[model samples]
Every structure is written in structure tokens, then in C-alpha cells.
Target chain A: MRNVAIIWKKEIDSYFVSPVAYLLLTMFGLIFGFFFWNAVSYFVIIGIESQMRGGGGPMSVNEYVIRPLLSNVSVVGLFFIPMITMRLFAEEKRTGTIELLATSPIRDIEVILGKWLAALTLYGCMLLFTALNFSFLFRYGNPDWKPLAVGYLGLLLQAGGLLAVGTLISTMTRNQIIAGAATFGVCLLLWVLEWVSGYETATWAVVLSYCSVITHFESFAKGVIDSKDLVFYVSLIFLGLFLTSRSMESLRWRA
Target chain B: MITVEGLTKRYARHVAVNNISFSVEKGQIVGFLGPNGAGKTTTMRILTCFLPPTAGKATVAGFDVLEQPMEVKRRIGYLPETPPVYPEMEVAEYLRFVGKLKGLSGANLGHRVDEVSNRCAVADVKHKLIGKLSKGYRQRVGLAQAIIHNPDVLILDEPTAGLDPKQINETRDLIKSLAGDHTIILSTHILPEVEQTCEQVIIISQGRVVATDSVQNLQSGTRGAETIRVEVSGRDGSIEAGAVRQKLEQVAGVSRVVLRESSPQLAVLEVESLKGKVVRGDIARAVVQAGWNLNELHTAAHTLEEIFLQLTGAQPTLEAPASGEKQ
Candidate 1:
């Protein structure tokens, strides 16, 4: 546990000391802020239209504003998560510091957990930055806080699952660009996998939708915490990290 | 302490380290000498647990490298051919991270960092980023990181490769100072470096161990024949170069005499003595009795360079580099 913390600390320090962390923060903040502005304006326009009609009840802020914004945040992550996780191992390999880590006394699991946790923490920070815009909805209108909390939990689980896959891809090459591109490709595939079920109800389509990361996240986004969804995210995280450990073992054999 | 038996590493097309075996005793400084592509780095990597051997067994500090790698890693410090450094990190920060990674903590880690930086003469650049430092300073930082934890065994590949002469001398002195406390295996192609710092040398060529012995023993054992250089001057050009070479060849115990230089007033010749013979005195007497004024006469001791070339089957006196090129 101490070894994991030590490695985690160094990785976090490296992120902050370089320009990458700041670049990622700035880009994520601006993009998410744009989505936030659009969602609120659209909600306000719809609320006024209903009031002008003088026929319908008040629009739920949770439905019109927070839910859309949260879902949009997940979409933005498709672009940003790759950036955060690309350098986890690729940069170490490129700089030759992987040699030091490989020959150190620490276990391979500790190294993987340490780096993955650091990447997750950075992603958490980006999520927190988006929450700044969401606070406006709670202050101006009455929205249930429980569902908002659930939505954020969903984001965390979803990001954790994707970041694990990103970590595995990072170990495949020493080039950060290649790692980033390959990770985005895989994440996009996972996101769009549910589209196959829209066309038909065949067994292959059902299985494909079951594998989609978005399918598991939708329940959490709707203020529900189903055990099946939770299991899917956790399982993806485990599979990704397990494969990463295996890849690390191969490095010892092929180095 | 280290031991290896039938250690081999084969790449896709070629064998890097063939079935070669050698051992280093506790507190001994051994030199790993080899030409380029001779598998010095490959062998060091295997011992350091950076890579597993394709076929064989090896142990470090009494722990089998293949079986108990974590134990082996805990007891050994390794510096690869290229100094492994993060260019963006400051020297102090980098050393601190490596110290923590090696399981040093609290005041002990801080004290050892200071100690190794001082020992390697990198304290002045501890705050500087590694990428901005000169090659010599980078090499020193690499050395400092390796010794921060002060493991039982230190494996360094081409440690003095890119340093200036002054830094090279300082590194040699520092390594010599570390002899009795740490078992070190350092690899290099420079002959004099081994003579100056290492007590024993394991010379590998063509991915095989050609010879393994102490410096003195290898030298004496390979001194099969002797060469006596004699510089003779004449009184008003009395002796011709051809006549002098002919006469020196006729001397007992002398096998071949080759004239190195011929001038009107002076001549220099190298006389090769027969196997296991001391012919310097014989050549000196022959020159004096022949009425040739002998200005200088000395038998050149066989050098490690010649021994290395002969053992590696390189040209006897190669003008090409022995092993300094990149593999």
C-alpha cells in the first residue's frame, strides 16, 4: 500500500509539473462550460414556452437542465479521457524510466493501481470543474439533490471503466499519440455499441448492447443504482486492469 | 556475490549471450569486457532482473534471479548503457522519487539522497532539470540514483561512457573508493579502465566468455612470446639497416628481427624472442659486440590491448575501434 502511494504521488507530481495537466484542465473546462450554457438556455426557452401556453405544470429542472448537461459531460469525456490516460505508461517508456520501475522492488499490481488511481483522480478533478456550472441549477430552482448525486456517481463509474481501458492501451506503445488515438477509438466503439440493438432484437444485437458502456451508465443517469449496471462497470474496470498487468508481465519477458 | 550457469539469451535471429558462466565474489569489483554486440548489456540486464534469460540459471546475492526476482531486485542497483533519466525532472526530485521507489523513507531517504549526490558530485546541479544538464552531469546523476539505496550489488553498463576526462577520473576514484563495501560489476571496452579499477576481468567476444582471470594472471598467462626494441646509432653510418637486421636475426633465442626505422645515423629494430625466452640481454650484447652504438634497449611488456585483440580474434593491432561503437 505504501509503495502504491509512493508511485501514485510521483505520477501525480509529474502531471502537475508538466504542461499536460493544465492543458487538459483548460480544455475540459471550456468545452463543458459551453455545453452547460447551451443546456440552460434551451431549458429556459422551453420553460417560458410552457408558461406562455398556460396549460402545463412547471418543468422539472432535473429533466430539462441537469440530466442533459450530465449526459453531455459524458460525451465530452470521449474526447478528454484519452488525453488524461495516454501518458500513464507511454511517457515512462519513452523516457526510459520504465527500466527503473521494472527493476524496482514494487509489485506489478502496485504500479498499475498507482498509475490508474492517478489517472482517475485527474478525471475526477475534471468532473468537479463541470459541477461548478451545475450548482447554478440548484440555487435558482428546486431540484432533487439525490438524482444529481447519482448522476455524478454514474460519471465516476463510467470514467473509471474507460480509464482502465485507456491504461491498457497506453502500455501497448511508447508513443503518446498512438496510445491516445487507440484509446479514443476503443472508447468510441464502446459508446456506439448500443446502436446495434436499435436496428434489431437479434441475439447478437442484445449482446452488443450489453457490452456498451453507455447501457450500464444510463440507469445511474436516471437516478437509479441497479446492481447489474454497477457490476458491468466494475467488471470492465477489472478486466482492463487485469489485462494491463498481463501486458506488464510480457514486458519483463520481452525487454 | 553473483553466479551464473549456462546463461543464454537468443533473439529472433541471433544469440546475444551464449552459454557463458562466471562468478564474482563478495566485495569484489569485476570488469565485464567485450566488443560491441558482445552481450555485456544483455547479461547485465538478465542479472538485474530487467529481462528473463531465455535458457539458464543465475543468482544474485544468493537469490535466484529467475525464481526470487523481487529479492534480487531489492539487493541490486543497475545503471543501463544509456543513463535512465527523466528529462523533465529536477535531479533532486528524480533522486527523491527513485529513493522512495527503492523503499527508502523519512529521514533515511533524505540523508541518503544527500550522501549519494555529494558522492557523485551532483549536488551542484541537484536543482537543475536533467534535460538541461551536461552529459557529464547526467551520467553522474544516473550514478547517484543507482547508489542512493546502497544495495549489495551494483551493476553498471558503460558508466563512464560519455564523461570528460576529469569526470571519468573522478568516477573511477569514486568507484575505487566503493570497492570493499559493494560488489560491483562494471562493463566497458577501455583496457586501461579495467587495469585501473577492476581486480578481475571477464572478457567476452562473439557472445562467449573467451577468458576470465585477474589482471595480473591474464597478462602473465598471455605473455607467450617477447619483443625487444633496440635503437642503435652508428659511428659515421658504419652499420647499414639491412646488415643490422640480419645480424640481430642470427643472435641466439631471437626468432625474427624487423627494422622499424632506418636513417643515415640511427636505426630502430624490434627483435622477437623465441617462445618462453628472455632475449633482451642477448640482443644488447650482440649490438655492443657488433660495435653498433646501442642507444636504447628494452623489452616491451605485453599489453592487455594486444591480449584482448588476440583473444577476440581481431587484427593484432587494429586501427579500428575495439568496442566503443553503439550496438
Candidate 2:
């Protein structure tokens, strides 16, 4: 556990010391800010229209503003997660520092976890920046905070799953650009797996839709915490991390 | 402190380290001498737990590298051919992180970080980012990181590879000072480094150990016959080089005599004697009887370079033309 913390601290320090962390944070902030502005303005315009009509019920900010904003956060995460996790193992292998980590007393699991956790933490920080934009809703409106919190939890779990996948991909290669591009490709594929559900009801299509991460995140976005959704994200996280450890083990033999 | 038997590492097609075996006693600096791609680094990697041998076993500090790698890693500090350092990290931060990974913490970690930084002469650059430092400083930081935990065995691959002459000497002194507390295996192709710092030399060639012995023993034992250099001049200020070579060749037990250099006034020749023969006295007597002024006469012991070349079967590029056929 202590060794994990040591590696975690070193990895986090490296991320911030380089331009990667800042570039990621700034880009995420700008993109999410744009999405937040469009969502809130469109929600306000719809509220005004309904109020002028004097017939529709009060609009729920949770449904109208927060859900789409949180959903967009996940979409933004598809891009940012790769950036956060790309350099975790790839850079170390390229720079020869993996030799130091491999020869150290720490177990391979510790190093893997430390790096994955650091990526998660950096992603968490990006999510926190979006929280600043969400705070505006609480200050001016009577939106329920519970659903917003659940939405954030769902976003984190989803990001955790994707980051684990990124971590595994990072271990497979020493080139960060290749890792990043491949992670984006895999994430995009996972995101689009649900498209087949709209066209057909075949069992394989159902299974593919079930494997899509958005299917599990839908309940969390609506403030419904399903045990199956939690299990899906947790299992995905476990599978990705387990495969990462396996990849790390094989590296010693292949190196 | 370390032992290996029949250790071998095979890639997909080629063998990196062939069936090789050696051991190191506690508190001794053993020089792993080899040319490039000679499997020195491969052997060290196996011992350091960075890679497993394809066959056989290795133990460090009584811990098997294959069965108990965590225990083995706990006792070994390794510096690869390229120092395993993160360029983004500060020197002190990198050392502290490595110390923590090696199971040092609290005040002890801080103290050791300071000690190793000072010991490696990298204290002045502790706050400098490793990427910004010069190559010499970065190499020192790598050395400092390796010794931060003071493990039982230190495996350094080419510790002084990129340093200038002054830094090389300082690094050598530091390595020498590290003896008796840490058993170190440093691999290099530089023969003089082994002569200066290592107590034992293991010369590997083409994935196999060719010779393992002390520097002096390797120098003296490689050649079966003894050689002596004799320089003489005619008493009358001129000498026949061919006739002098003929006279020295006639001396008892003298197997071969080649004129190394000749001028009208002085002639220098190297005389090789048969095994177990003392031809120096007879050669001196022969020169005096011939009324030639013998200016200089001394035995020339085989250098490490010649022994390495002979053991590795490399062509001796520095051998004189006349003695080239003797090989």
C-alpha cells in the first residue's frame, strides 16, 4: 500500500510538472463550459416559452439542465480520459524508467494501481471543474442536488472504467500517441455499440447494447442507482485492471 | 552474496545469455567485462529480477530471483545501461521516490536521500530537474538513486559510460569507496576501469564467459610464454639490426626475436622465450659479449587488452606487423 502511494505521488507529480495536465484541464474546461452554456440557455428559453403559454407544468431543472450537462461531461471525458492515461505507462517505458519500477521492491499491481489511480484523480479534477459550472444552477434555482450528485457519481464510475481501459492500452505500447489514438478508437467503438439496438432486436444486438457503457450510465443520469449498473462499471474496471496486470507481467519476459 | 547456475535467456530466435554460471562473494566489486552485445546486461537483468532466465536459477542474498523475486528485488539496486531515471523529476524527488519504493520512509528516507545525493556528488543539483541537468549530472543522479536504499547488491551497467575523464575518475572512486558494504557488479568494456576498481573480472564474449579471474592473473595467465623488450645500440654508434636479431635468436630458450624498430644508431627488438625459461640473463650476456651497448631491457607483461582480445578471439588490431603471424 505504501509503495502504491509512492508511485501514485510520483506519477501525479510528473503529470502536473509537464504540460499534459494543464493542457488537458484547460481544454476540458473550455469545451465543457461551452456545452454548459448552450444547455442552460436552451433550458431557460424553453422555460420562458412554457411560462408565456401559461399551460405547461413547472420545468424540472434536474431533467432539463443537469442531466444533459452531466451526459455531455461523459462525452467530453471520452476525449480527456485518453489524454490523462496515455502517458502513465507509455512514457515510463519510453524513457527507460520502467526498468526502475520493475526492479524495485514494489509489486506490479502496486505500480499499475498507482498509475491508474493517478489518472482517475486527474479525471476527477476535471470533473470538479465542471462542478464549478454546475454550482451556478444551485445558487439561482431550486434544482434537487441529490440527482446531481448521483450524476456525478455515475460520471466518475464511467470515467474510471474508461481510464482503466486506457491504462491497459498504455501498457501495450511505448508510444504515447499510439496509445492515445487507440484508446480513443476503443472508447468510440464502445460508445457506438448501442447504435445497433436502435435498428434490430436480435440477441447479439441486445448483447452488444448491453455491453455499451452508456446503457449502464443511463440510470445514473436519471438519479436511479441500479445494482446492475454499478456491477457493470465495477466489473469493467476489474477486467481492465486485471488485463493490465497481465500485460505488465508479460513485458518482463518480452523486454 | 549472489549465485547463478546454468542461467540462460533466449529471445524468439537468438540466445541473449547462454548457459553461464558465476558467483560473487559479499563485499566485492566484480567487473563484468564484455564488448557490446556480449550478454553482460542480460545476465545482470536476470539477477536484478528485471527479467527471468529461460533456464536454471539465480539467488541473491539467499533469495531466489525466480521464486522470491520480491525478496530479491528488495536487496538489489540496479542502474541499467541508460540510467532508469525520469527526466521530469527533480533529482531529490526522484531519489526520495525510489527510496520509498525500496521500503525506506520517514526520517530514514530523508536522511538516506541526503546521504546518497552527497555521496554521489549530486547534492548541488538536488533541486534541479533531471532533464535540465547535463549528462554527467544526470548520470550521477542515476547513481544516487541506485544507492539511496543501500541494498545488499548493486548491479550497475556501464556506470561511467558517458562521463568525461574527471567524472569517470570520481565515479570510480565512489564505486571503490562503496566496496565492503555493498557487493557490486558493474559491467563495462573499458578494461582500465576493471583494473582500477574491480577485485574480480568476468570477461564474457558472445553470451558466454570466456575468463573470470583477477586483473593481474588475467594479464599474466593469458599468455603461456614470456616476452621481453630489449633496446641496444652499437658501441661505435651503428648496429646491424638483422645481425642483432640473429644473435638474440641464437640465445638458449629464446623462441623468437622481432625487430620492433631500427635506426642506424639504435635497434629495439622484442624477444619471446619458451615457457618456463629465464632468457633475460642470457640475452643480457649475449649483448655484452657482442660489444653492443644494451640501453634498455625489461620484461613486458601482457596487458588486459591483449588478454581480452585473445580470450574473445578478436583480431588484435594493435599488434605489430612482424608478430601478427604468431597468433
Question: What would the per-residue lDDT of candidate 2 be over residues B264-325, giving only the tens digit for each residue?
Answer: 99999999999878899999999999999999999898978878898899864332211211
Clashing pairs in 1: none
DockQ versus reference, model 2: 0.86
* lDDT tens readout by residue for model 1, A185-230: 9999999999999888999999999999887877787889999999
Give the candidate number with the greatest DockQ: 2
Q: What overall lDDT, based on C-alpha atoms, would model 1 receive against the true structure?
A: 0.88
TM-score of each: 0.91, 0.93
lDDT of model number 2: 0.89
Deviation in Å, model 1, residue B217 alpha carbon: 2.9
Candidate 2, B68: how far from true, in Å? 1.2
Report the error of model 2 at residue B229, Å.
Answer: 1.7
Counted clashes in each candidate structure? 0, 0
